[model samples]
Target: MNLYTFGKALVKTALTPLYRFEVTGTEKFPDQGGILLCANHIHALDPPVVGMTSPRTVHFMAKEELFKVPVLGRILPQVNAFPVKRGMSDREALRSALKLLKNGEVVGLFPEGTRSTDGVLKKGLSGAGFFALRGNADVMPCAIIGPYKPFRKVKVVYGEPVLMEPYRERKASVEEVTAVIMASIQKLLDENSEK
Candidate 1:
């Protein structure tokens, strides 16, 4: 395996026991092939928490500003994450995501586009829906509940995959497709919230 894959595995393995980790509906994740893992953003720690618990390597997009720093830039790429400009439609980021999916790599995305200060599902951006249609990948809804601080227990839930066919038709608007993607994540969150 490449350094990125190895590093991700190492971090995930080490962190798994640190949190009171409980994963529900993980079987819903595809056993193989490219998959778009759509997740609801709750905290900054949500990425690694979900990434480590996932059964496969998940390539995600990080903010470009984070890459401007010397150390983070180097490490982010090593973990299979690329930088995307904030407040803009970054075609390059989108293309990179699509390329990863096309190559059969699992891509993790926060449809909210950013973390929510309050632990609630937010409106999703169209970028995820756009990539799903372009790459012909299945959108797997993920819900991560609870906090990361104080080294307490947390919960991450993966929901059933939502295929891209119904929205692939040209008649469907991007906003409509994005809404559907968010709804899937929201449903998972609602189901797993108490835990």
Candidate 2:
């Protein structure tokens, strides 16, 4: 097996017994073509959980700092992660993401930019919207709920893909497109809150 598949298998096996993990709405994920997986950030563990549950290999736009770590720096790229300088537009990272999408790959990102320590969804950054419009890609809103503690139930829900055709054709502003994506993510969060 490849490194990603092997790593995902290891995580799934280890986390399943520690947390009651569940996944739903996976059929909504596209079988092919470029697509963006936008999700809300709740914890550090969020990305791995989302990646493992996804139907395709998810290339994450991780913070540049993670790539600074000796071992992680080497491993992350191999597993499809590229670093982005947080709080500022990193042109290189943006180009990388766009390139991946253009090549029909799945790129996952947390719109909030960083993990929400208090568990409240924060305002989304405009990068995701920019990528969707520029790359002519579909955006899939995903919500991850809990695993707050060991043995706690954790759920990952994938919502219907938000087609960028209409928004792109309308020349919607970045903020507008971002709002639509965030709203979709919020809806998923609300729907799965009790689960």
Candidate 3:
């Protein structure tokens, strides 16, 4: 495995016993090239959970303040995570994401823009749809179930990739497209969760 993939595996191994990590439908993930992974964020650990569980290297957009933490700041960039300014669409952040995509690197985006306090899927921003359209990349809708906590069985369910062409040509507004994407994510959550 590549260094990034190895590092992710190590993280997964370390975290698994702490929190019961059970991921299914990982086979649905694309085996190669770039992909835009859109997921519902419910906790601060969501990004790392997805990053470590995914079959390929997944990059995350973190808040700028996170980079100030001595340990996390050093480790994040090493593991393909970069900083973004929260509460604003930082153009530089978007550009950095786009650059990764253009180079066939996968990027993980939380459509809710931040973690959901109630652990329920919320209305998503249009950034995901916009990225898929602008990047000409497929969006892999993912659903993360359970609280990411010690001894909890947290599941990361990845769905088949959703192509952008149909959505882009549908004449629907960006908000409409985002709604559709969020709905798909909710469906995955409803079906995959331990009921």
Give lDDT for model 2.
0.90
lDDT of 3 by residue, 1-195 (tens): 655777777877888889987888889887776689999988877887888888888888888998999887887788888899988879999899888876888999999987789988888988876777667677889999987778978888998788777876775576777777898899899998777
Instruction: Tell me the spans in candidate 2 whose CA falls farther than 4 Å from its real position.
Output: none
Candidate 2: worst 10 consecutive residues by lDDT? Answer: 146-155
Candidate 1: tens digits of C-alpha lDDT, residues 31-134: 88789998888888788877778888788888998888888778888888898998988889988998999898899889898889888777888887788888
Instruction: Tell me how many clashing residue pairs each candidate has.
Output: 0, 0, 0
Q: Which stretches of candidate 1 lie above 4 Å from their native place?
A: none
Q: What C-alpha lDDT, on a 0 to 100 scale, does residue 73 get in candidate 1?
A: 79
Reference-based lDDT, each prediction: 0.83, 0.90, 0.83
Instruction: Tell how far residue 130 is off in model 2, in angstroms.
Output: 0.4
Residue pairs in clash, model 1: none
